[model samples]
Target chain A: MILAIDVGGTKLAAGLVTPDGHVLETRVAATPQDADAERLWKALEELIAPMPEAEGVGVGCGGPMIWPDGRVSPLNIPGWRDFPLRERLAASFPGRTVRVHNDAVCLAAAEHWLGAGRGHANMLGMVVSTGVGGGLVLGGRLVNGGTGNAGHIGHVVVEPGGPLCGCGGRGCLEAVARGPALVAWAQEQGWSPGHGPLDGGPYEEGRAVTGRGLASDALRGDPVARAAMARAGRALGLAIASATHLCDLDVVTVGGGLSQAGAPLFGPLEEALRAHARMDFARRLRVVPAALGQSAGLVGAAALILAGDRYWDAI
Target chain B: MILAIDVGGTKLAAGLVTPDGHVLETRVAATPQDADAERLWKALEELIAPMPEAEGVGVGCGGPMIWPDGRVSPLNIPGWRDFPLRERLAASFPGRTVRVHNDAVCLAAAEHWLGAGRGHANMLGMVVSTGVGGGLVLGGRLVNGGTGNAGHIGHVVVEPGGPLCGCGGRGCLEAVARGPALVAWAQEQGWSPGHGPLDGGPYEEGRAVTGRGLASDALRGDPVARAAMARAGRALGLAIASATHLCDLDVVTVGGGLSQAGAPLFGPLEEALRAHARMDFARRLRVVPAALGQSAGLVGAAALILAGDRYWDAI
Candidate 1:
């Protein structure tokens, strides 16, 4: 069995996964927002308290994380910057193989192992959620760039001067296509999250306009809502086209909250991708929804050790 | 010693290199434009005739080539379409290890092995001649993207609605940044290659307005000429920014005749890249001129086998 720890801005979860890739036991806790370092550590300890002994452990967390040594300064979780989560975790569980990876990379690894990206030699796995993030599986091996930041597609430029990004850049794909950006654009077009449509389809009273709510609104035939998603798809498609061209990738699997937007998100994404990808090499790109959902982080983290020589790190 | 061959639109060159990466002997031949298959075969045959006894051979040609079993239909050498260059070369060599790679990939491999990209774990190598081409080395392994076309950055769209690309796409980087396109744009601005300046910087008669002529003019302080190159640089920088972002590259080494245009070509390229690359991971990308110049192809092709387990093709 392997121990899998998943750290996110809002949650801390731990699971005991089997050799055949099954999560036999799991523990969860809400990550207190803006909590101090000690609180975060205590929450993690509580999350993993129920996990049984295992041969190896994998921790998947948001980046800017240092590679190998595993230090992280995740956005949103403001309490932790340059946090040595790996060192602390390793110290907690002595004599067990421990590995840390970017949460999106873990998601990609999980998808590659047991979901949509399986059997592809070279793939790009993306998570378009509160933020856009990605990971690469090249030549059938997960790539770890020197900084372990091999995939950061969110910051790639699609529109040269469109808008200012949180990353301090203009026209970043994330700035144009992420969940918040979509909602913001929809609002500009008279879309209010809780307001719904004038002749709304099955509106729940006082529903907040969250990313999920925006997706449901599009499904209920809101033109402005649909347009917002389409705009996101267009920007994402352009960036994917650029990526497919550069990486010669055969497939791209997308997950995360925006992915839950389903066909409303994918339909326009595919259309725009088809429109932009015209070359023979890039024409064959396959964009698909990720199969594994939230559990991907934990599973992929487990695979870091359970998958054995797959890292190809030594090579 | 290893046998190395470089096939290009304009030239076919072959060499025998020592184990220490030295070219012991070489041969050159002009690749006749639009020649028939027989003529192309004969040229290759003649080029490889005088090679010394070698354990293996590596051929690097401009692509649209198949991997593992190499078949190439180079854009410039239209004499053969889908020609089995690998099969034919292997047949002649008789049981020796004969490998074929895209010339640009070979350049990347060469740069990774013995040139500007040396010591960098992940690198991008580019060739910006009649057409643009590129290759990648991720985590120190030459990436073939299964079809031997992973790094076709030339066809990646930088300007979504700008112009038509030969690959049936709109606003491909190649359409904006290639020699032909640069020359076309320069002419629209009333810059004539042979005409030089109104009070010419050192006027010479009978110079045709080829891509090389345009670069020469730019070197002589022609505003229109310099603008054309800078425009190309801007497009290139945007494309490189996208590539660097997607690949999380360490260094980008550029070769090709245009690179010889010197700082005028690079000055703007760097500026544009920096302007687009805003993220810390991307900001660290180092762009440099390619070393080994014209011979990178031959030497890199030889590296396919010479580099030992580095190819990771079987995995």
Candidate 2:
């Protein structure tokens, strides 16, 4: 068994996953606000207390956190600069091994081992949730760049004159298709968003106003929602097409809340992909819905610890 | 000795390269116009006639070409769709071994074996000439994607709101910083471009106007040229940063005509890279100039054959 922890800004999830893709048990908790080292350590212990025995611990977090040093400073979490996440996990688990990777990268590993991208040697797993992120597994190994941030697909630009991204770049794939940005785009188009803009309400109280909401509205024949989803699909298709062109990837597995809308998103995405992909081989690149869903991160983290040094280096 | 052939849109270069990085003899010829199966075969024969005896043939060409089928259809070289380039070479040299790959991929191989990226396990070789292109060498082996197009970095978007590219994408790295695009951007800024736009006179020949030209003008205090070079550098930096973020490459070797500008481009490129790169390990990634210059393709082609089957799946 392996202990897998998925750390996010809003919540924390930890699980014990067996070798055969089974989730033995999971623990969940609200992520403490301004999680300093002490608070985070407590939260981690609370989540790991009831887990089954493990060989090691695997951590999945936001951003390209440090690998060799085992520190992390996720943008979404305040006061986390150089947080010793790996050290903390090692201390918590004692003598076993511990490995950490970006949440998206773990997602890719999970997808490759047990999800939509199973059996594919080169796969890209994209998470189209509140924010856009992804992981890449090429030549049967995970891709972990120098900063351990190899799969930051959200930052890639899809439109030259579309919208401004959080990274200060204009028209990045994130800026165009991320949930908040999608809602913002709808507002800019003179449409009233069902959940208002992401900026309003209590900071943590605001709900995601894209995807499912848009899907419902489209079902009700709301033209704006239909158009918004279409726009999101087009942007996503363009970004995926670009990835296909550059990496020659075999499969793209898309997941997260946005994917719950199913064909409403994939339909237009496929059409847009057909429109944008230039070469014959690129046209043949596969795009599929993710299988493991929310459990992907936890399972992937387990996989990281189980695979050991050779696989970790490949990653 | 190994026979190396660099096949391009307008020219073909053949060389006899020994194991120790020596080019014993070289041959060059214009690529046949309106090339058919027979014409291309005849042209290859003419180019190879004067070269020294070789044990095997290695070829580098513009791609999205298929390795499994040995077919080629480069963007600039029309009428080559599904053409069996390797079969022809095999037929000509019956007892000799033959291998083929994307030109940029070959460059990466050359960089690993004999150039600036030598000794690195994970490397990227970028060609910033007529169009931006690249190849990857990971774990000291080449990374050939599904159809030998794994390193087509030119299509990656540096600025989501920049310009149009020949591949029909907006704001691709190629659109903002390739030789022709750099000159076009300079002209659009109201500068009297020494090189004409893509369709005007001899300057329209496309590949001639590189970042080096802008660097020369920058040295002369030409504001537009200075800005053009800056943009090119930033674009290149973003691309490298993204590659580092995703590939965990330790070294990046830049080649082609534009890379000749040296520090004028490198300085700003480094600055832009610093801004986008992940903090940890970002500082460790090194960007260097290619040492092999024009001979990279030929040298890399030979290296491709040397590396053998472990990397065959990638190309």
Q: B27-118 in candidate 1: lDDT tens per residue?
A: 89989777899899998898888774777888888877767678888877888789999899888888798888888888888888899989
lDDT computed for candidate 2: 0.75
Error of 1 at B174 (Å): 1.2
lDDT score of residue B288 within candidate 1: 91
- Per-model CA lDDT versus the true structure: 0.82, 0.75
Residue lDDT tens for model 1, A193-311: 64443333434765455566687678667888888888888888888888888888888999876676677788889887887787777888899999986678889999898884664
Question: iRMS values in order, in angstroms?
Answer: 1.4, 3.1
Docking class of 2: acceptable
A221: Cα error in model 1, Å:
1.5
Error of 2 at A260 (Å): 2.4
